[model samples]
Every structure is written in C-alpha cells, then in structure tokens.
Target: MSIVGTEAYPQDICSGGGEMKNLWASQRNNKGAASPLLHSRGGCKGKTQDCSLALSPPLGSVSLKCLPLLEARIVAWIGGPPASGKSTLALRAAQYGFLSADCEPPSSGPDWLSGFGAVGMTNRVLALANASSWLLGATTSGMVVGSCYGEWMPSSPAHIMRVLLLPEQGVYQQRHQQRGSTGWSTDGWRHAYRQYRNSLLVWQRDNGTSIIRIQDRPNETSCPDKTLFDACEGIMAHLDKTPHELCFYCRRTRPPQSAFWLRCPPECLGREGGERGGAGHASHEGASFPGASSPRADSDHSSKVATPAEMEEIKQLLLATQGGRLDRSATHNWRNPSVPGRYGYHSIQIGNVNLVGQRNPNERLNILRSFLNFTGKVVVDLGCNVGGMLHHLAEVKHAYGFEFDPRCVKAATRIAEIFHLPEHFYQANLNTFDPNSTFRGLEHAPDIVFVFNIGSWVGQWQQLYQAIANTGVPMIVLETNNDKEGAPQLRTFRDMGRKVQFISQAKDDVTGNFRRKTYLVTPA
Candidate 1:
C-alpha cells in the first residue's frame, strides 16, 4: 500500500528515482499544499481517503510486486498445450525477473471471483496484464512484462510480444494421453487440440508477435530453454527504443550514401518547395475520366446500371485480394507493423496519419523534387502503401507501384487516374516478387527503383537485392532506421558491387528522432 500524507515517497513503492521525486515535488509545490501521497512538513488532519499524488494519470492503490514489475519493458504471451513444457518455462522466466501473478482468489473471496473456470482464469490474467500496461502507458519509461498461455491478448498498446509455442505433434499427443480430461474420449482430446492449434496458426500469422517454433532440438528432443532465450533476446533487443524502430525496421544509424545526398534545387528546399498538382505538369489540367470511379470515393454509383457489375467485380477482386476476408485479418497486423497506433502499412487512411511525411516532410519532398526533370524515366515503388509519394513523382516520371493489398491497389489506382498521371499500382508481395514476369511485356527495364519502408521484414532485403541484381537497375532510393539492424541490407547492396550513397534524413513521428535516413544505391 502507498503511504499517504507523507512528505517523502518510499523508494520501494515508486520508481524513477530523483526525477520522479522532483516531478512530484514540483506538482505539490504548484498546488500550494502537500499532495495526499506527499507528506507536508506541517501535518494536517485530513482524511485518508484522498487519492495518491494527484497525478494527471491517477495512480490507484498498487501492490509492491506490481510496482516493481513496471521496470520490465516487454510483455510476452507464450501459448501452448498442457504438458508442452511452457509452464516450467514460464515459471523459470518469472523467477528470472519476468512478473507473474496467479489469478487464484483468496478463501474469503466469493466463488465466482475465484477464477475457477477456464474462461475466468483467462479473464483474470488478461485483466492483470492490461492493468500493468495501464501503468506503462502512464509514464514514458518503465513497463510490466507478462506471459500467458493459449491465445490471450492485452488491449494496451504497450510493448507487446506474442510467442506461439508448438512442440512436436507426437510429444503433444503423448502428453495429452498421459493426462486425458476426466470425461474426455480419445477423439475429444484430439478435437480440442486441433481447435486450439487452428486458432494458434491463425493468430500467429495475423497477430503481431515474435514467433518461437520449438521443434526437434539438436538431440532431436523438444526444448523450451532455447526458445525462451531466443524470445527474450529478441524482445529485449527492442527495449527502451522508440516504437518506430522495430524487429522488421530500424532507424538508420549512419549517414546514407554520399553521392545521392545532393541538395535540392533552391526552389524545392524551402517552405513552398512542393505542392499537390503543381505547375510542372499543367498540360493535362481539368482532365476527367468518365468511366474512372472508386467505390470508396464515389459511394453513389447505383445511379448508373453498368457500374454495378463493375462494382461487383471490384468487390470480388477485393475479397480475393484480402484472402476472402470481409474485414482486416490478424496476420495483416503482423506483416508490416512496427508501431501501435499505426498497426499496419495500410493504416494511413484509418489511423489519421501521414505515414510518409509525418517526420520531416521536407526530407521526402527533397527526394521527390530531385526526380522532377526526368519525363521518360521509369520509377517503381516497392511496397507503396497508397502511392502518395509516387503520385507527386508521377507528374515527372512514369511511376508504377507494387503493393501487397488489393484495397491499397484500388485506392492508389483511383487517385492516380484522377490526376491524369501515367502511374500503375499492382498488388504483389515484394518478398517473392518475380523480376522477369513483373517486367514482362514492357519495352524497357526500370531505370530506378524506390524501396521505401519494406526493407527490414523477412526476405525483404534479400529479395529486393536479388531483383536489383537481376534487373541491373542503376539507382534505388530507400529509408532505414538508424539502428544496426538496417546495416546488413546496405552492406548487402555494397557487397553486390553496388555503390551505396547517403541521401537525406527525415524525422520519425513515432520516435521523434531524425533516424529515418534515406539512401541511394547505384550500380558500380
């Protein structure tokens, strides 16, 4: 319990050291009285019911254990079946400083409050984890980590780590057989496992989590030790860093390639440098495509008869593009996400964000301004979300975008056609993007490639490098987090006998740092 009507706060109950103390003192002084949590030099006869410290994000009564656990930065949810060895691993992990609170109730508490049932146990654990996240959300630093089993999620967007632990099927089956449910038949246990396994696979792809696939070990035995260590290492690697630099992406650590970091023409450097639909491409002004319409933009297409068939086709295409889901799936959240509010690459419209220009807009404006003079050059953007950057550049060059989402493809195509720019947006996973087939039926190979935010994910750098190597594209522009994780991709480009040049730096909205460094790699 927190001490009230006291001048000094206990070091054990609250953290942040001198800084936190000083912050509390300043607030108390401004209020012209000792806060309930802070003791006044002259003790006053006040009731004990006053809240603690009167902080903006109020701190309710907290246990000593939960307060200390706030120091941990990452919360992991480790899921597996019974006797899969995760319980021991979870205990070991908690003993090693990861926090765990058994949701069992006291003897005096009501039976309903005991968390006796399976759903009740899960709910209690979820509540505890979320309460800890609430504390983390209150302060810039400090977190309370947690681990749970079999498909649990904390609603708070604090540092979250999800691990789906899967031992060998034989091992799992053996364990289940040894301890079968009291009323369960042979098929009953098997069916339960299959259901949980399906959900695990679904969430593993859609839910954003660092994965631990514990299969046959060195001795052909399954072990949770190695898997736990790997998960901890990966989780800690991102501790204390800004949400911007994640496992898939990091802010650039050094200056980009020197050759590509040229200053923009005097006009493009200042405040009025770039504007939407500017003077350079005024020949196609007041252009209109009678048949071009978007379902999102023009909601009332029912007035036209043939448009319904077209809309139906678009709907089917979208459904197929979304892997037959009417709504956003969980795996999509994991694929290209590094931040909380901005969960995925296509969240630009939903998240009320300028995914590109949030950080120093001038940095990207500078990059786009440099390509203004090339009218006939081919510019390709891999992983273009909504084609915002390409829309501006399309005014000067022939722009084509390869995106993963059909929804994004449709949105980009509508915007491109509206501007009367010759830009094509196609949906394709950049990791497995085919070069020859992608460039098929075209007259000339792409002169330049735009590799933006997709470099840090699985197979991204390698596949992009392979495509560049195979195509011999002269110049490529991309951004990288300043952290060391991004160095390997640049190194790979250099290793391919390509000369990498530093371009410009942009501010990251998430981290509020100038770590979004851009680079240009050219063939030697």
Candidate 2:
C-alpha cells in the first residue's frame, strides 16, 4: 500500500526502516520538505524546511512484514490562569523524563525564536519531533498552541494533549496574591481566567479535543507538587505509556550505577558536597531564633540564664508595665527555663528570663503542628493575649497578633521587641475585625489563622469568621470554649455554612476544667 500527500499511513508501512531512511535521505539531499516519519526521528535537525516526503510505491508493492518501531510523539500543552502552577507542572514533567519548555519568553537568554512566537513555530515543531513527550506551559488562553500554532502540530490531533488546571477562584486569587507581583490587576486576572475557561470549552466542542481538567476542591489548599504528579500520571495514561521508575534520591528515571546506591551516577552521594540530593534539599543547619530549636529562628542571643539581678529587673518591669496582673481570664504564666517550676506573664526567653505562660504554649503548638506546618508560613493569631502562643511559634515567617485589650497588645509588643522576634501585635475588637485592614502592610496573605477559644467571648463571632473567610486563608484553627459554652459556638459556626473539619478534642490542659474541641474551618 502507498501513502501520499501527508495522509495517515499504517504503522507497518511507516516503520519500514530502509524505505523511510531512503526517502528521508533523498528529501534532505534535494532540500525537499521533511516527512513526519523523519521528523519523529529528529531528522530535521534544526532546519525550518517544509515537510514533503512522498510514498510512491504501487499498491501491495510494500511488504506487510515491517516491524513497527516509531512511537507516537506527544506534545502536551498545559494551560491555566496565572499562578495556577502551569510552569511548575511543566518542570515537574521534565523531571519525569519529558522534554519541557515554557511558552513565556526567556528572561535572560538568547532571544531567538522566543516562546511559541509565530517565527518560532518551526523550531517548536522540530522540538516536538525530537522528544517522545514534550510538556509546554501554554499561554493563558492556550490559543497560541491550539489555534495560532495549530498548523505546526503533529498530523494526529490525538497526539496533542491539552491540560487545563481549573482551581477554585479563591485558591487562584490566593496564589496570585502570594506571588507578590504587580503584573495583573484583580479585573485583569479575572478576565484572563474567564478567557482560559471559554477557550477550553470551545476546543472541546469544536475541535473535538479531549481536554484534561485538574480542578481543586472548594476551599481546599492546592498542593502544587501533588497536582503536578497527578497531571504527569494522567498524561502517561492518556498516551498509553508507562511512567519511568524514578531514582529514590534524584527522582529521575536514570538507574543507579551501584547496587548500594539509591541515586544515579550524576546524582551520586558524594557529588553534592555532602548536601542532600534532588527536591528534598537540606534546610539550613543553624537555629533561627534565640532559645528556639527551629531553623527559622531570627534572634541573635541564645537562651542565657538570667542572673538574680536581671530576673528582679524583669519582674519589676512586668509589675510596672501592667501592674503585674494577668489581662485575660487565663493566666500568662511565663516561665524561666532555668527554673521550670516557676511561671510568668508570657512564654519567651529574654536574656535568660524564660517567661513561661500558665497555658503550656508548647502543648497547644504540638496540636497545631500536627495539623499545619509553621516553617516559613505566615500566621495570624486572633485574640492573642500577651503573645504566648505567637511567641512560641517563632519558626513562622511572620506572626501577627490581634487583642482587644490595649494593655495586652502593649505587653505583646514589648515582649517581641525585647526578644527580637519577627512578630507584630495590634489592638482590634474581634466584633469588627477585618483581615484586609489588619494585614494591610503585609507582602503575603496569612497561611494559617488561629481563633483559639475566643468564639464565646466575641459578641459578633459570625462577622469575624466572615471577614477571615473573605481573605481565603487555607487553614483556620478554631478552638471552642468548654463543652457547655462551646456547643452554641460550634453550632453557630456550622450555621455559617462553612466546611468545618473536626481536628481533635482535648481537655484545656491549662484551665483543667473544660474539654475544648478544635476544628479546621475552610470555605465550602
């Protein structure tokens, strides 16, 4: 059987090595257009020449015994709104043995044939031919790859996969805000998001394209790594290809050179100069703050045992500042590390005076740590009295506290300044708390919000919850009052129609009377 004029040919005919090779050589010598079969084998090199290979054999002249050798080439175009993790997913696909390139122009490189531009279509098409699989980070609307560059695609539409990540609007907006770039305004971002959705719909209906949509659950925080891995798996399944087994150390398909090694030759144990390999990079090895074991601590001084004179001075300062009274219902039993038996107004180590609060902040922190990671994350503590919890959470990138009492706020501020902690405190009534106003000067949105045991005390808890919800924070740790008073609070929270995931219930280790329940609140 003979195939002509860019028509699809059977696998056996297309895979005839001698015939295909002779045809490709003849076309190259004559400067004629290259065949898709030749292109699949990277025959074009870097040329922009046209494709014009001809199969002129008589019907039945070609034998049917040719072994099929050419694997279908695939070019996956990944599209989504800005900050939807398109670039991240493309790079991840590269780690999984796929050739990857971004559609955006290179920021610092030779600008030739930049980023799927019209002039670069030939180059990109040649790239598509060279790799078994290519993952391209597409433009917002994906029209560049789907329409403008359609002519440059492989002959089989089945080989061009379009994947669109459609995370919830709130999640998208939150990611955009975290990027801290001024490239797009709110209106502009919304417009681009809509354009992507509309374009995908049109491609599905008009082109009969099978579009893959990766969507995030409502109010759930999207994990880019997990999303990217799932997408790569989906693409592999769609292509009827098995994913390569990756090395445990490098996360690559290359096999280890030695039976005792977990990493490939390029990623051998000693190659990284004692550093950890691949994405599991080792964290910096020093303490980040004073008296804190966390690597993110930011203080210069270590926990030094305060001399008797310094302790007396600290005691006098606490007494003179707030008349030595615990502002909130719970006592701020700050403790000295040297004397574990003693407790004080706050839990902070200041030149040896370890002010340990009555409520074991570490105990509460352990519960929160199990649910959320504080390392390099922004935290907002609602009704943080004397900064007990926030003080202990020094590992966070930045900690902000809000308390209704001015005295409590002042004390919290004093503690932070003395300890050289990266924390800020403000006095704000919970009834009218506004996240935007509270976090006005912040560069990033809060990652975790704490509303511990303050629902019953705040008269307008609903308003506060609504305000926090509007911020689109991924996690909210809410601890209700004791069972009796907390029942109404819990019911009210549920009535607000938010998704409340029960975390755990434990007795108030500090108060010892109430068994409080902790829950995670997310948008529905």
RMSD, one per candidate, in order: 20.1, 23.6
Candidate 1, residue 308: lDDT:
47
lDDT of each: 0.42, 0.46
- lDDT (tens digit, per residue) of candidate 1 on 1-524: 01111222233223322354366545543763455434321112232211122222221222222222233333455555544544444543443445533223322424332331224454454344334333332332222232244433322222344444555566566655654222346776777587458535534443333333344222332223344444444343333232221311111111133111121222222221112221111111112222211111111111112234443443343233222322354232123324332323331211111222222222253333333233346666777765655654422335667666656576567544433345666666666676656654234457777777566543556766666666777778767766475688788888888877775565324335566677778778
- Write model 2 residue lDDT over 1-524, tens digit each, in one string: 00011223333433333464466556665534544553432212243322222232222212111100001123566665656666555543333334455554344445333421223443343333222111211111111121112222211111245566655556666666665333557786776566556544433332322344566656543343345434534443433321111111122122333222332333222322112111111111211222222222222222223457655655544443343333445343211222232243343433345443334454456445535657668887888876777766634666767776655666666655554565766666676666766554455568889988777667777677767777778888888857787776666657766778776665324234347788888767
Model 2: lowest-lDDT 10 consecutive positions: 63-72
Q: Which stretches of candidate 2 lie over 4 Å from their true place?
A: 1-346, 349-351, 507-510
Question: For every model shown, what is its TM-score relative to the native structure?
Answer: 0.35, 0.38
